[model samples]
Every structure is written in structure tokens, then in C-alpha cells.
Target: MQKPSIPRGTRDFGPIQMAKRNYIFNTIRSVYEKYGFAQLETPTMENLSVLTGKYGDEGDQLLFKVLNSGDFLSKTEENDYQVGSKALLPKIAEKGLRYDLTVPFARYVVMHRNEISFPFKRYQIQPVWRADRPQKGRYREFYQCDADVVGTNSLICEAEIIAMINEVFNNLQLPDFTIKINNRKVLVGITEVIGATGKEADFCVAIDKLDKIGIEKVNEELIQRGFTQQNINKLKPVFEFEGSIVEKLQFLTTYFAQSETGLEGVKETQEILKYLDSYKLENDHLELDLTLARGLSYYTGTIFEVKANGVQIGSITGGGRYDNLTGVFGLKDVSGVGISFGVDRIYDVLEELDLYPAETGAQVQVMIVNFGSEMTASGLSLLQKLRTQGIRSEMYPDAVKMKKQMSYANNLNIPFVVLIGEDEMKSGDYTLKNMLDGEQAAYKINDLISKIKNSH
Candidate 1:
């Protein structure tokens, strides 16, 4: 006999944990729905070709590949067995668990392009699998709550995304945070102006570690990554110039005035800022952050990352504009921008801050005590009545000790308990006890339902 266990990176959620998780998902879903984004779902496994090359090299390495069924290794040659996964993976793995919802979504749009309307806005809340090393606040299997608007390059969509982020965090009652906004084009423009356009990937990858590695160490990393002294000199201003976001933008506008792509990004950012102003989201809540480089290869325009102030968690959420993600799937010129809420990380933050509501548990508003066989029927009847009245009520399956049933209700944190012993059943009334304050009152079943409903 084998022991029962799950994969290391995966988690098994218990009832209480499920309740808390549902609170998070429902909060984000409600906000997504409010923004006119329809819900969507993609399969757990997608074709390897569909997922490959969408994320960066590092991300692709972390994807969980599924082995082909039915003698997967039967076709592998003896000589090919010694090679690395690069040469051997194709022979064994035909499918892969989805790395993220966004890539599968892009594939979805291309596959269903004809059936769907243009400028499609959709939201997906699904578990994605990764093969990364597990740690606190990092998992192999985690849920991503994503909302994206594709087929449109409108800045209004970007503003709406920011608004949706605000609404989600606000509804969750998360403490003050910053929704840092940047544009990938601006980073590209910086590389171009620095005469390192060919090394843009290396440059961005190095600077993306600015928070983890100091500026001097970043310059050293860039040098190690094959950047020239002249390019490093040009990049120094970005780190050295410290001021408000508007001042930094002013500097960028002056520096990259001639680059059309850079100027277009500026215009798009201006529109976003204008729309945000119309919505009045400016302040510490929404601000321009020049240092945000979302390391993903797909982002082409506006980029975003959110960080909570006074908390020590990583980016709680992030996403950006990708100009032509669907072009790889035979659809060209369709642009999209979206954000992903890192639900697990957010859960950690909320737990650390003690922000989760106390009442987050299974909704057993009332538990009916089971007496002997005679009162069991009465208790079941009362349970049905309470349920019919829109109250979440349950009863002990067996007629056990009164103390044992009450203990069960107490352990479950049920707010109220109903005693349906013989005396109460004969008197045509039920004893309703408030577990919180230990107050008891006797009332007819009808009046009891009404009182619970009205009081709640």
C-alpha cells in the first residue's frame, strides 16, 4: 500500500481555507464583472506549441510538461537518452500544463476569433501550474485572477484596468498601496537612446533587478552581461535622477522626443493619466513609476506593478500591454492589456496584516440539536423550514449527547444553535441560543425564523 500525498508545490485546501479563498476570489470576480468583463475558462492542459515561446526563457523553463500517454518512451532512441531535456522533451512530452492564463487566453482568442466579437473583454480565474522551487508565498500550483481587454488599443481600457485594480483592493479593504505604472516602450526608448537597442533584453533583465541589487551592482551586472561603458554612462541618469514621477516623465519626454515609438508611448501614458484624473485616482494610490520593468517579453506598451506600502510582500499584482500576442497564432495587429492578481501572495499579505474578516467560515448560521429518534424527525423538519426561509441550517446526523452536539456547533463557529428537545417540540417552540453572548430565548419556529432574519 502506498501513502497518500500530493505534489510538493500543490496545496490541499481545507474547509476554512476554502472559505477564505472564496472571499478573495469573489471579491476580485465582482470587481471584474463590474467592469463589463465577461468570465472565461481555458483547459488545464494546452498544446506544448501553444504555450512555448509566449513567456520568456526563464518562464518557459518553469512550465510543467505533461508526458504523452501510452508508452511515452517507446519511441526514444538509445543514443538520444543521454542528451539534456532540450533534445529529449519532444519525444516524451506532447502536452503541458498551462503556465499562465494569459497565454492560453491568447491562444483561445486566435482559435475562436471568428466566433467572438472584436475588442473582447474577458476575465479568467483558474489554477496555473509551474515547476518552480516552492517556498513561502510561492507555489507550483496557484490561482491567477486575470482580466484583459484585447483587440483594442484604447487607453480607456487601460484606465478601466487600473480602476478595476483599485476596486478590488478597496473591496478587500487592503491597506494603502501603489499601482506603479510604466511603459515598455519607454524602456526600449532608453535602450535606443543609450545605443544598446540590440542588447535591450539583457539591459532590461539586469535593470529589472534594481530593487534586489543596488544601482552599482546593476551597472556591474550590465557590464557582465556585455554592456559597454558608454551605454552604462547613458543609463546612469535613470538611476541618478531622483524626483517626482512627473519630473522623471518630463526628463524622458525631453530625452526621447525624436523617437516615434517613445512619443506614442508618452501620448498613451498621457491619455491614461488624463482618464485617471477624470476618475480621480491620482495620489499615492496611482502614480507613475519609472523603475517598473515587468521582465516579461510580451509586454510592449504600458506596464504596471503594484506594491503595498508598510508591508514586505513582493508585487501583489502586475500586468502590461502586449501589442501582438495573438499575432503568433495567425491573428495580426490585435493588441491587448491586462493585469493579474497574485492571489496567494495577496493572501499572505492579508494574513500577515490580519485583514481577513473574522466571519470567514462555512455558513452554518443555525445548527439544530438532535434528540432521540422521535425528535430527530422534528429536528429534520425544523432544519428544512429554516433552510426554506434562506437560513443556512444543519442538524446532527445522529441523536447524540446534547453537550457533544453543542460542542460540534461551537467548534464550527456556528453563531446560533437551536434546541429541539421534547419539551420544546411539545410546546411548539424552539430554544434559540446565541453562542457568542450565551443568551437563550424560546420562540415559536415561525417567530424564530423571522427574528433571525430580521436581526441578521
Candidate 2:
């Protein structure tokens, strides 16, 4: 038989990992619920037509297409089909694993428009697949924790998303970080002022890497993309300008004064800022970053990306406003803004910073001693009573020696051990040992449960 193995870019999460992941998911889910957003899910495979031409060129390349099932070449000559597979693959494969939740949500909205309420607020926690090469933080298969508000043009949704992001990181007790906010229209304004309108895509894509690739290389990329020296020079100051959000907005007022669209972008950003100020979260938590041009093509108005302080990882989370995500599906004028939390990256930050609660992997809380057949029965009875009290109590299956049982408990990091030998059984008591401090005491069953419940 072939040796058993799973595919690359996939992970098998064990109990402890699942527990930690559950903790993360539940925390995010609770926050999403608190904001009154309902949950929604889309299928893993969507029609190829719906999925394609949605994500931009690079994103389309990374989509995982599903081959037609059951003798897919029945209609074609064998040799000709083999020859044409390279060109005809997309046509033959009519479905694909979804790339992200946002696009699929758009498709869902269009298909179910009649059944849904307006200004729909929904949260989706689902696994999305990509065909890209796997890396430390980037994976071909991973989960996206997404929350989007659709069918409304109100900037309140944008502010709510910002506040949601803030609440999530804050509740996670994440260390210092900043939520970088920008507007795509502001990007368009920059392109217009610099005389590079249609080339806005290229400009946005290049500057999106300013954090990763630096400004020098970004300029070189712009020039390579056919931007003139004068254009690059005009756009360079917008990036190089750094100060308080107030100062930056002031500078932008003068810079984008000539362009009406740029001014509107500035106004939208200021409105979000004013909301931020009125709500008055930690002032340091939000920043107006001119360089934050998230490269995704769907974003139309506001854009957001978050970075962890003192870490080398890329943006830990990002999302933006899409003016017509559903319009592509024939549902026009339905605007939406959403955000996705990069769970894997957040896990990496927590691991590096040692912020995960030490008790995160804790499974067993109490272990009972199995002395002999009779003592074991007694121990089992006590274990049942402890478990009924909500303690994760278990006994060693074998009638192991006392020292061996103790060693087992120590290895498992079980915090409490209950000794129920013949004497303790006869005395109607059990010896509870605190593994960490090695303190031992004999107590009645009720007293033991009370102590464990109270202390632990």
C-alpha cells in the first residue's frame, strides 16, 4: 500500500489546537453577534463564471479550479483534448473552490435578493481555498473571519467596522498596533493629480507594497509601469508626508484642493475620523495612512489594513468598501463594506509575543489515582462525582503503581490529583494533591469539589 499522507498546504488540528482555535473563533463570533450581525455561509464550490473576472488578475491566477467530474473528456477526441487542456481548462472546469467570503457573499446577495432584508449585516466564518504556494503566514487553505454590511451606502458601516476591529484586538489583549485607514477615491485623486488616471491600478498595486518593498523600489516600479518622473515626484510627497492625523489631513486639504474627487475622498476619511474622535477610542489606535492602498480591485471607497507593533509579519488583517460587489451579479447600486481578520497571522503574533493564555492548551483538570481493582472502582466513583461538578476528572486506566500514576499526572500537567486508596475509601475521604505546589490534604468528597471549584 502507498504510505499515507495528506496534501501540502493543509493542516490536521489536534484537540488542543482545536481548543485554541475555538477560543479564537468564539471570541470573534461573540463580538460579531454583539453588533447584531447575522451569520451566513456560502458553498465551497461556486460556478466558474461567478468566481472568475471578480478577483483581479493575480487573484484569478491563484484560484483552485475543480475539474469536471465523471469522464470529463467524453465529448472531445482524446489527443485533441489532451492538446487543448492547457487552453480549454477553464471552460471544462465549470466550478471552483471559493477564494474568499466577500465575492461569494455578493453572489449570494444577487441570487437571493428577494428573500433578504435591506441593509443586511452578516458575519461569515468559513474556510477559503487558494492555489498559491504555501508559506509561513500564507496558506492555500485557511479560514477567513469576515463581517460585512451590505445594501447601504452609509459611512456608519465603515465606522462600525473600524470600531469592530478595535474591539476584537482590544479584547484579545493584543499589544500595541495601529489600524491604517485609507480611501480608494483618495488613491484615484492621487492618480489624477499626478496625471496617471487609467494607470491607477498600477500605482495602487505598487504603493501597496510600500511597507514590504520600501519607497525607492516603489518609485522604480512606477517608472517601469510607465509613470513619468514628474508624475512620480508629484505623488512622492503624498506618501512621504507623515505627522499627526490632523496635520496629515491639513496637508491633504491643500494638496487635493484642485481635484473634486480627491476632496470627496478626503471628506469621507475625515467623516470616519470625526466618528472615531467622537466615539473616542484610544487616539493612538487609529491612523490616516496615505500609503495604505490595499491592492485588491474590488475596493471603491474606504480601505483598511492593520499591522502588529514590533513584529515582522505583514498586515495581520485587512478589508475595504466595495461600491458594486453585487452589481456584477446584476444587483446594482448595493454597496457594502467588510473586514477580514487574518487568524493565522494573529496566531503568529500571539505566539511570538507569548500572549496566549498559559492555560489555553489545558485539557485535564483532575486525575484520580487507580490503586487496585477495588481502589480503582472507588476512584472511578469519585471521578464521576468530580466530573458531575464540572471538573475534567479522569483516572489512569491501568492499576499502575502510585509513583507511576503520579508521573503520568505530572506529564499531562494535570493540576489536581485525587488519591482514593483503601484507607481513604474506608474513611469516606480523598487526598487532593495540588500538582504545582505539591500540597496534599485529605477532604470529604463535597469539600474537595468545593475547593476545586472555588480555587481553580
Candidate 3:
């Protein structure tokens, strides 16, 4: 028999991991609702046409396409196989696993345009797939908890997104974090000034990897992509400068004096920060990072990425403005800005820091200790009473040995155990055991409820 194994890039979450994941999801979902956003869900598989090209060239390459059902190759000829895989994909596959939530949301907006209100604010927490090589902090399948608002160009939305980012990390009890902010317009303006007009995509892509690959390799990549040495020289100062957000924007104002677009991007960044000045930040601070280019092709205005301080993992959350995303789906001029929380990476961070509460993993608060057949009959009535008052309680099946039942409760990390043997049943009192300290005491049914309820 062949040994069973899962795909290398995927993971199977056990009960504890599921509990932690739900904690993360519920935290994000509650915040989304508090901010007046409704929950939305889209199908796992979207049309190949809908999924393609929205992500840039490299992003498109990572898409996991689904093959057509029922003898998909029956109509293909020998000539069809001669064409390369890229060329022949359309012939065999008409659908694909969604790369991210934003693109599908765009498609949803266009299809339901007539039925919904403008500037629809919706939150989605679902799993998405990619075919890229996975490593630490990167997965083939992961969940993206995204909240977006469309149909408006208000900078208030941008400020609100920053506020949301702060609230999420704060609620998660995450340690110090930095929210890096940038503007795509600023990137375009820099390209125009440096004479790399047509290479904006390449410039953003290489710069986005700056922290990963370092400056030397990024310079080499620029040359290979047709950027002149002089262009790099002119662009060198943008990477070299460092200061406070206000100071950095001031420098950009002076540097982009000749470029109208660059100056506009700076003004927009300034305005967003201005709006954030009055709001009290909880756990994060925003920074102006010119090098923070989130290389997605759809981002048209402000771009954002968040990194957890003191942790070596990549951005735990990220998103930005997509002014033209809806246009491709036949809904013109509807702009949207949003961010996504990477739940898998966040889980890894929480685990590394040991931040999860002790009670988080253990679902049952109390377990009824089964003594024997006679004791089991009376235990059921008490068990239902405990459950009726909304305590998470369960009974071990099979009236087994005392040692075996105690071992079962310990394995589950159950905090409290109730004992109802023949003596307790006749006396009309129950013995409760504190699993952590192993102390047992007798109490009436009403007193048992009070003790368990107040224990936590």
C-alpha cells in the first residue's frame, strides 16, 4: 500500500489550529461589521477569463487553472498538443481557482451592479489558491480576510482603511507593527522623471523586492529590463532618503518639483495622513515608504503593506486602492480601496509568540466523569442542566475506570470535571475536580452550577 501524504504546499489543520484560525477570523469579522460592512461570499472557482490578466504577468503565471470536465481532450487534435502549455490552456481549461478575493469581488460588483447600492462595503473571509512554489510564510492555499468599499473616490475611505488596520492588530493583541504606505501615482511620477516611462511595471516589481533581494541586484535587474544607468542615478535619491513621514513627503515635494504626477501622489499621501492625525492609534503607526510598491497591476492610487514588528515573517496584512479594477469587468469608473489579513501567517506569528489564551484551544469547559451504569443515569440529568445554562459540558461514553476517564479529560485540557458516583447520587450532591490542581469537593447541583460558572 502506498503511504498517504498531502501536497507539499498545503496543510491540514487539526482542532487546535482550527480554533486559533476561527479566533482570528471572528476578530476580523467583528471589526468589519462594527465599521458598517456586510459579509459577502463568492464561488471558489471563477471563469478562466475572469481570473486571468487582472493579476500582472507574474501573478497570472501563479494561477491554478481547472481542466474542463468530461473528455476535455476528446476534440483536441495532434496539432493542438504541439502548441505550448500556455497556448493550449484555453483549449482544455475554462475555469480556475481564484487567485485573490479582490478580482472576484470586482466581477461580483459588475454582475450585480443593477441590484446593489453604490459604494458597497463588504467583507469576505475565504480560502484562495495559487500555484507558486510555497515556503515558510507562503502557502498554495490560504485565507484572505478582505474588507473593501467601492463606488467612491473619497480619501476618507483610505483613512478608514488605515484605521481598520490599526483596530485589527490591536484587537488581535499583536505586538508593535508598522503600516507602510505608498502611492502608485508617486511610482509613475518617479518613472516619468527618470525616463523609464514604459517600464513602470518592471520598476515597481523590482523595487517591491528590494527588502528581499537588496539594492545591488535590483540595480542589475533595472539595467536588464532596459532602464539606463542614468535612470538609476536619478532614481537613487528616492531610495537613499530617510526621515519622518512629514520630512519624507517634504523631500518628495522638492524632488518631484518638475513632475506634476509625482507631486500629486505626494499631496494625496499627505492628505490621508492629515486625516489620520486626530484618530488615536491603538497598536500600529503608519510610515511613508516610497519603496513600498505593492506590484499588483490593479493598484492605481495609495498602496499599503503591514509588517509585524520583532517577527521575521512577511507582511501580515496588505491592500490598497484599485481605481480601475471594476472597469475590466464592464463596470466603469468604480474605485475601491481595501486590505486583507493573511490568517495562516498570522496564526504562525501567534504560535511563535505564544500569544493564544490557555482556554482558546480547549472547547469543553466541563466533562462529566462516568462512574458506572447506575451513576451514568443520574449524570445525564445533571449534564443537561449544566448545558441548559450555556456551559460547554460533555460526558465520556462507556462507564470506564476512574483513571481512564480522568486521562480523557486531561488530554482534552478540560478544566473542570464533575463526579457523580453512587454516594453522590444518593446524597444529592456532586464532587467537582479541578483538573489543573486535582482538588475535589462536594456540592449540591445549584452550587455546582455556580462554581463552574464563576470558575473561569
lDDT of 2 by residue, 1-456 (tens): 899887788788887677677777887899999998999999999988888887778788888989899887565555666677555775468899999999999999899999999899899999999998877777788898999989888888888888888888888888699998989988888998888888878888889889878889999999998999999989868977989878987888898878888889889988887776667776437888987888788999999999999988888889999998888899899999999987877877877887777667768888988787778678878888888889987988988678998998888778889888778978998899999999999998889999888864
Arranged by lDDT with the best first, the candidates are: 3, 1, 2
Ranking by TM-score: 3, 1, 2
- Answer with 1 or 3, whichever has the higher lDDT: 3
- For candidate 1, the 10 contiguous residues with the lowest summed lDDT are 281-290
Query: Which candidate's lDDT is highest?
Result: 3
Using TM-score as the measure, name the better of candidate 2 and candidate 3.
Answer: 3
The digit string of per-residue lDDT tens for model 3 on 1-456 reads: 999999878999988789899999999999999999999999999999998988888899999989999998876778878877866788889999999999999999999999989879999999999997998999999999999999999988899999988888888888688999999989998999898887789999889889888998999988988899999999989999999998999998998888898999999998988788767564348888998888788998999999988888899889999999989877888999999999999999999988887778988989998776788788898889999999999998888788999898899889999988878978999999999998899999889999988986
**Lowest summed-lDDT stretch of 10 residues in model 2?**
73-82
Estimate the overall C-alpha local distance difference test score of candidate 3. Answer: 0.90
* Top of the candidates by TM-score: 3
Model 1 RMSD, rounded to 1 decimal:
1.7
Query: Measured by TM-score, how close is model 3 to the native structure?
Result: 0.98
Alpha-carbon lDDT of model 2? 0.86
Q: What is the C-alpha lDDT of each candidate?
A: 0.86, 0.86, 0.90
Q: Each prediction's TM-score against the native?
A: 0.96, 0.94, 0.98
